[model samples]
Target: MRILASLQVRLPPSRLFAPTCPTRLKSFKPLFTSPNSDLPLDGDDDPDMTDPVKLAFARAEAYKRQKLQAQSQKLEASLSGNGGSNAALENPSSSANQGSRASQVSAPKGKPPEAEIIVGDPTKFENIRRRGEEPEKDDGETEAYRPKVKTWGVFPRPMNISKTYGGGKVIRPGDILETKEDKEAKEQRSRELVTAYKSKMGLDVDPKLIAECQKSLKDGNELMDRGRLNQALPFFEKVMKDMVFESELHGRAALQWSICLDSLQRSSEAKVMYKKLQNHPNPDVNTKARHFTFSFEAMEFMKVKSSYLSRTTGYEMYFDSFVDNKEAYTSAKTETKEAGETQILPYVVFLVSPLFVILLIAVRKSFML
Candidate 1:
């Protein structure tokens, strides 16, 4: 028993509170060792210990440290007024505030962009004269000097009325001064009247032919009123050739024929017909035909005049030279007045003559007794 106890003491304590073997324990060391150990803990300290994730983290930390150092150097330089590059670097807090303000400015709620205004020199566009600038004079063209005439008094000088009428000195209020147009119109009318008279005596047109021509002219006029110029042209042209020039129907047919020719673009033929109609014996026909000879633009002006005159004055006279025959127009009024006077005279005579005859009979009976 003594020998077995000694051998057990000599043998190492049971592996409960101590390692099994010193050499084995040293061989199977922990992954993390003492802090003072020379072996690298991170993979960056040892180039041979390559770990992708750890190497990336180590590189990022180094880059961040370098960037901070550079930013601090820049800030110090700006504060010292040595570097003109980075003004914001001198005050980072204010720069951050300005950046936020810029972001807000870019984000407009719902407003349109402002309109850009452009200012330029007006003198570059046009030649403008200044107030104090002198006007340029024309070369070799001096203004003509006119002598002022003397005036005796403020009242106007009297015109010699006798000098105008062969020194007769007779002034008439109702006398009308004839214009060139009026004189020409009167001469044309006289010539037309003479031609009409000669035509009536020379041409022995049958009454039946005149009646048929008048009927044709009336039908043509009705077609023209309905805007059927094409259909009316043939009828008007036929009547214009067959009708006697002295007849009133001839003037009407000639005027309608010229109007159709104008509408059809036969301007040359229309001009000839209008020239002939200008000297028509009928006043109404001559005036209407003369208006057709005017320029198209002038005719439009006359149309406005005619409308105004027709409204204001119950008569439709376009030209100032055209005059209506007042004697013919007043014939009916004169006849009515004469008829009334004759009727009164007849009643007066019937009443007085009986009295006269009775007195005469009484005188004769006294003489016989």
Candidate 2:
């Protein structure tokens, strides 16, 4: 009250926002009054100077009363006379105002406009820096121009994957990636198969025959080492010419015979013996047969034989491996030579020129001495 008295003219929200037509509102009565409104605001003379809260309550009550009156009037018109058209005719301005308010309340908001895109000619580059500029009309090149296809990179979907050997092993198609367990199982199965085959053969060598074969093999090897191939021939033939194919002695004798035949320039016979030794029971004999040292004539025969065989066949890959390594080494050397050219700086020529002059002077001094 003291602050209001000091100001001499008190300011409140109700007076600033008072309705324009007070005379019409003054005659109206509100149905719902605020129970908390004990602010002496219902006074006839000081309506503009009322508390802001009281004024808000009064306005809300007035609005509710007006809505109720309008709805009741609409209902009365429908019951007594024509209908909605008559009600619209009776309150055209109010109906228009209500429509405008409804439209304002339910109005859709706007968004920024989308970017405009213009396609260009199919034959031309669309992203050229300068507009209307084009490439040359044609060149003498006969090759057709092909552009890389535009494609989206689709991420591979997650899969519930499993492997034969389990995780941490990188496998590719046709790779023989055997794990320890698989290898062991394979070895066991192979042993079983070999035992079964041997049992099926059912034939046994006599003790005397085995002893004689061993003695003959030793004598043949000793004769061969002494360069007496003709003398070794009879002993090796004695072991190889019999039904001792399953014995290690027979394989050894066959290998020695092939060697002797190759040394004697009997290449055709040597190749047959070597090929026969490939299926020997002894692993060492089979390996030696496949990878034996041969004379020039034998090697020539092998070349002819390999030409008839497929590149993936036995010993063909071994032949190609040496050629492949040579080619690779040659290519690497060529690349290194091309890349390692000595680069001499122009300034280093000055140092070299002085050294050459000193060298010439030293030579002249030596000649003078």
Q: Model 1, stretches more than 4 Å misplaced? A: 1-204, 296-369
Off by over 4 Å in 2: 1-203, 293-298, 301-369
* Predicted structure with the largest lDDT when compared to the true one: 2
TM-score between candidate 1 and the true structure? 0.27
TM-scores vs. true structure, each candidate: 0.27, 0.28
What tens digits encode model 1's per-residue C-alpha lDDT throughout 1-369?
878767743565453332111111111122223574322233224334354565556545544555454445555455457773565655466445445544554465787865644369765745544455664543533443222344554332324435444475455897756668989998999999987776784345777887788889989999998989889998987887887665678888988888877776676687787778778778888888778777544756767323122336634556333665433356788999999998899899998999999999999999999
Report the C-alpha lDDT of model 2 over 270-355, residue by residue, as the tens digit. 78877787787789998888776343346577675332334465777778877874644357887777656544455578678999
Model 1, position 171: C-alpha lDDT score: 57
Q: What is the lDDT of residue 228 in candidate 1?
A: 91
Task: Please report the candidate that would top TM-score against the real structure.
Answer: 2
What is the number of backbone collisions in each predicted candidate, taken in the order shown? 0, 0
- Backbone clash pairs in model 2 (N, Cα, C under 3 Å; residues 3+ apart or in different chains), count: 0
Local distance difference test, each candidate: 0.64, 0.65
